[model samples]
Target: MAGFRPRVPAPADITMIAHHSVTLLFDLSDGADLAHDARGRYGRGSVAVGLLPGDFRASGRAGEVLQIRLEPVAAAALLGAPADLSGEAVPLEDVWGRDAAQAEDRLRAAGTWGERFTAARDILTRRLTELTRPDTRPPVDQEVAHAWRRTLGSRGRVRVGSLADEVGWSRKRLSARFSSQLGIAPKRAARLVRFDHAAHLLAAGRTAAGVATESGYVDQPHLHRDVKEFTGLTPAAVATAPWLAIDDLAWPASPPPAPMHQRP
Candidate 1:
């Protein structure tokens, strides 16, 4: 989980970028602070932002907000139907109904960030538990799960063909099934992961040339091209993104992801 509380009066750039996970956001302010991006406008309050394939710039007045990132498989289990989210910001009530409002209330009532975090965790856990009690969404495909994990584990360096081989299916079959379940092709997912990794490295103070080499790009220009494609910004600009400066600190356990934004 992460928090955003802009320091200035200027409406924060709040410019959105591509993300690899399904992000759950709780708007702590009056819900009028942030504006939406091209995919769709996120109505204030609780919403889930789906994986964005490319840049999603948005502007908004600065305010407090909390965020949670869920892996695609976990998101499938927890969110259930509409397991096929693309670049949309879906209202939580659409999925959780009135319970979504109640959960957001819990977060809003919390006196501290820790309290809010705990509240969010318990709420999600309860939802996941409820799914197992009766009629529920089918579990994620094991082959697809393995393929995704492999792609992320290898930092997107692995080929989809090898994943197909490991899963005892042809490249074409694996890609089709994966897309059906995850709403994104394996190749695209890998590209996002690789780009995310490179962006995180840049945000962590790595030079474009260094990040390119370390992130598996052929050269700095190649890295620049990908960054531009994903964020509509040069590598240097992405490196200076205010939100990215907090990514490493917020999620230190994993290879840092600039998938979230938190005003410093």
Candidate 2:
């Protein structure tokens, strides 16, 4: 959970790399409509941005927004079907229906960031509690959920085959089940997670060659291809990407006005 109020003049375009989290962005300032984002076309004052299969470009001020990032496994349950979430963003109203308006109202009425955080937490907790009722969305399969955590825990280095073996299922069955439950195939999920870790390594001053080896790429060129495919940028360019520049400070135990990036 974090809050971001852009102080710098918002760029007309920003590059958002694929991440494994589902991002919920609530606009407090009634900013301009978002265009060409993960959702292709999206705007509703607030949105839940999902894990784009690859990097994407977004246009909006990101002005005064509260950000809540959820694990994709948990996201599968909270944000409607994982399939609908991937490759696009969804309006909060789409999932919450009419109650989304009420949540926005409470969020908007908060007096301080503290108040805002409380309001947001309350909303999320309430929704999660509702899912615990007799029937909501079906719970994510335990094996599939375990596979996701294993993928993330290894920084995407774990082999998909091994994951399948561990779960005592054939790769074909595992792939199908994982994709259905998680909104993406296991290999692609690993690639996205790997790319995410490598990008951070680059941003933290590691050489591409080093990152490649450390991140489990076949070689520098392999790393090059994956990075380019994910971000459409060279490893060097990604090293200084504006989105990754202040990452060290972006996530604090208690945040202080960071940028509201929908997985950017």
Candidate 3:
């Protein structure tokens, strides 16, 4: 979870890069407009943004907002419909309905960030627990789960074929299962993960050429195309993104690896 309260006015527009994880944004402000390149505009109070939200932007009003990132496996269980949200951003009300409204109210009533964080955690914990009861959807497949971990650990440099082989499943079978459960193909997931790593490198002042080399891209043009496809922005534009500026604060442990020069 991450909290933000802008001291100054919000940017007129802020480009949001695609990410591998599902994002939940709770707007404690009056309201904000979320415009997705594909889905048009949405008025957000509390929203569930799915994987690869494809070059969206948020504008209007600045106030306390909390964002939570959830892995697809966990989000599938919590939202009760991973496939439905694979590449879309839907209102939280669409998933949780009245429960969503109630949770938002509770969060708004909290006096401090700590209180708000606690309230949000309690709400999500209860929902996750209820969804994972014995009779609910089966737990995420063990092999698929491990594959996801390996992909993340390697920063998406792992091959899907190797992952399938390692997990003792045929490539076709692994792809089908992964898509059904995680709302993304394993190969696509790897690409997204790799793109995420490259994006962070760009944000950290690495040249596009350097990022492409270190992030496993074939060349700078490959990285450029991927970034443009995912974010609708050039690497240079993405480097100065307001959204990415707060990533370190929100996700500190996942910092980009040291520059090549810093390596032994």
Top-lDDT candidate index? 3
Better structure of 1 and 2 per TM-score: 2
The residue-by-residue lDDT of candidate 1 on 77-105, one tens digit each, is 88863345676776667766678777777
- Please give the lDDT score for candidate 3: 0.75
How many steric overlaps are in each model, in order? Answer: 0, 0, 0
Q: Estimated TM-score per prediction?
A: 0.84, 0.86, 0.86
The digit string of per-residue lDDT tens for model 2 on 1-264 reads 766656686743545677788877666665434443553564546777777635555556555666688888888777666767787776767866788778877987888788888888888889878776765546577789889999999989999899999999899998998888778899999998898888878877789999999999989999999888877889998876676743445432222224543222
Error in Å for residue 3 of model 3 = 1.4
Once fitted onto the true fold, the runs of candidate 3 whose alpha carbons sit more than 4 angstroms away are 8-12, 30-38, 248-264
Residue 45 CA error for candidate 1 (Å)? 3.0
- Please, what is the whole-model Cα lDDT of each candidate in the order they appear? 0.74, 0.74, 0.75
Model 2 residue 155 distance off true place after TM-score fit, in angstroms: 0.7
Model 2 regions more than 4 Å off: 8-13, 30-36, 39-44, 53-55, 134-137, 250-264
